[model samples]
Target chain A: MARTAGSSGPRTEEAIRSAGLALIATHGYAAMSLRQLAAEVGIQQGSLYNYFRNKQEFLFDLIRTHMQDLHAALDAALAPEGGDPVERLTRFVEFHVAYHVERPQQVFICYSELRSLEPDNLAAVVAMRRDYERKLSDILDAGRAAGVFRLDDVRMATLAILAMLSGICTWYKPGGRLAKDAVREIFLGMVLALARGEVPAEAVEAAPPPALSRRNGVARAGAA
Target chain B: MARTAGSSGPRTEEAIRSAGLALIATHGYAAMSLRQLAAEVGIQQGSLYNYFRNKQEFLFDLIRTHMQDLHAALDAALAPEGGDPVERLTRFVEFHVAYHVERPQQVFICYSELRSLEPDNLAAVVAMRRDYERKLSDILDAGRAAGVFRLDDVRMATLAILAMLSGICTWYKPGGRLAKDAVREIFLGMVLALARGEVPAEAVEAAPPPALSRRNGVARAGAA
Candidate 1:
């Protein structure tokens, strides 16, 4: 109930959070034990209780903190409200790739271990995720309104763009063949192209426009 | 080592695999014990060993089988070897979405539980995955050679495309507002646009082309 009594309390809690993230990322939430986590943090098993009431709470805190930090960082990184949607989208892609590329473990745990969260915790995390998604969705909406982007379905595009950016976390290495800057630039080009609906004129002529019109209907109806 | 000794052997093995997928999907590979798996399957713990020698093997088999089936299905679904890259890319997208949509549990486990596989098993699975990526990568390469797809980096494009399509599994629900056909069409459109290097003319005109030339150089050197 009360904070662990000492100057070392916050430091120890930070250690526990780091250790828990690594353990859960490696073995998953259900497979990670409080005892194992405490051992990893070099603390007594009971001392974990001083930081969190139970494992669910601990897991929730880890993910919630990650989302909170992400949202805050995104807010700081984004182009200001009412700015050009292109600039905002560009900033979004750069921020997302840079943020995710540096924290692959966090991204991995946040996505993969989401199944381990309890119902309420899951709802909270899902809500946070939706809020995060809405930021990009809003950018797409603005781009569409400004006649700068031509997306068939903004929501689908949002999910696809987010997934594509986040997927970088799965394989990106700090000292890998491509530098972070190069990766970011390449992805930026792709994301901007995607947002702009840059399909070739010949391809557009080749395929029927029914999917576009239908998707527009669906998007307007808020069905997808 | 030997079969479970009856017509029921294959049936029971199928049951174990189903239950194992559900359990691992919900609780993860490490947290799923042989006892729990057997209990779920209404068999004795020892019976699991009749099929899988250990949990690691069980996990490995689950992912490996998924990859094998995916490859086989993909091979069947792809356009003929010398066909148009656009058509091949289209088929790849449809096949991927269809295959992965019906098997979210398999997709989740294949990505999440890779951490649970032993090193050798991991390598085998990784190789299988690389082979899958190559299917998509080769299509992009062929498109590039034909001057149909103007990708900055074929490898990056391949990963991005796969990540975007596979991401549908995370949020897609059967009987949801969007039909599978519609979702597939939308994704196909986006992937085609991406492969075609469809950035808006204005956006390209606005931004410096340094990234493009650099990426082209990198792509030519096979550096990315």
Candidate 2:
């Protein structure tokens, strides 16, 4: 549903969406303004209605478009023939790391700003997110059942893993020492380490009871 | 650093911080008005300034208090005497899960609203968070150096692990299917499983080198 700016049509639309994403990302959804967005796009305030009905509509479009784009990218990355489930899952984490790291602005909106959408739009975005989460849950479940991964309670497992991936957006700044793939590779290793389990010899001596230690990357500190 | 409001003083300060935390958590910092916070505390708008210099100051104080509280609780739980790094670290995870689950609003503010703090205040908060992270890192290092835990890179290891723990806040609701302690126990189990590097032997035929197996989670053409 892209409208082309015969001359600078796409440019204006892109500008509007980019400004909206940035504003919503830095300032929460409700705090974002049509006035601020228009100025950010170098357009008069009223002109915004030409492209979007209102701020809510603009946000809905932004959330929908960004989620669709992410879903497509992740699906492609995890194509059936990609590799084994473990490798594909690692690729998914890598993709998540790259998406959150490279497009921090978009990532923030997809997360914190989706709430700004009106009821109908919010439902749509929620459905999309649920669908995506289901993909992760299924992958984990299959791995668990097939003896590829050993996670208990796939639902919580998926949430924990995705949360860890989303966090890449919160802290990862590209220019810092680690490149995108470096973080991905190590995180992949960590995920696999958790999924596949750890050193067998060490397990014999000190493995805590299963009920006490189920999470992977986010290790807990002692009680405070 | 509390000044007495006589008998009313301590309670009023508590009311103000609690109100500020709740407002900032739901509506966001920009949208939370001082007048609203005062109303929430059953005081006149102007009286809030007595407890806090301004709205930002109120938010600043709330955040600082939360961080300090987390530090104190964590220190109390991880008292260096009871257990090995694994058990100590597991207790830490359980503590985080329980605390964050019980106080979802504060957890939301700690994760989301901190960005809105003025530079100086933000720096203070960041320093506290960094200190907390370092404490977790120290445990990991202690475990690894002692030949108990194995990890590729200590820094990456720490971030990935802690992110998983804090990540719980985003999804936890006060009353749901999982109880706080149950979830915490699961996290502890998941992590300790990883720490000892024990994959359930059934998952792989030949040990999957480095990583065990890729995710088998994608449920294509099943739900949509």
Native contact fraction, candidates in order: 0.39, 0.21
lDDT of 2 by residue, A1-224 (tens): 34424537578888988887878888777777788888998777887888888777777888888899999998887877645667567667778877788898888778876545668988999999999999888777767766777664577778877776777777787698788877776666666667655332233234343334333322132232
In order, the Cα lDDT scores of the candidates are 0.79, 0.71
Candidate 2's displacement at residue A35, Å, is 3.5
lDDT of candidate 1 over B189-224, digit per residue (tens): 788877766553345335333211322211213354
Docking class of 1: acceptable
- What is the TM-score of candidate 1? 0.86
Residue A90 in model 1: shift from native, Å?
0.8
For lDDT, the strongest prediction is 1
Q: RMSD in Å for candidate 1, one decimal?
A: 7.5
Candidate 1 Cα outliers beyond 4 Å, as residue runs: A1-7, A200-224, B1-7, B200-224
Worst 10 residues of 1 chain A by lDDT: A213-222
Task: Compose the digit string of candidate 1's lDDT tens values, residues A28-70.
Answer: 7887889999899877798788899988999999999999999
Weakest ten-residue segment in model 2 chain B by summed lDDT: B215-224
lDDT of 2 by residue, B33-69 (tens): 8888888988788778777677777778788989999
- List where candidate 2 sits over 4 angstroms from the true fold: A1-7, A81-84, A198-224, B1-9, B81-83, B196-224
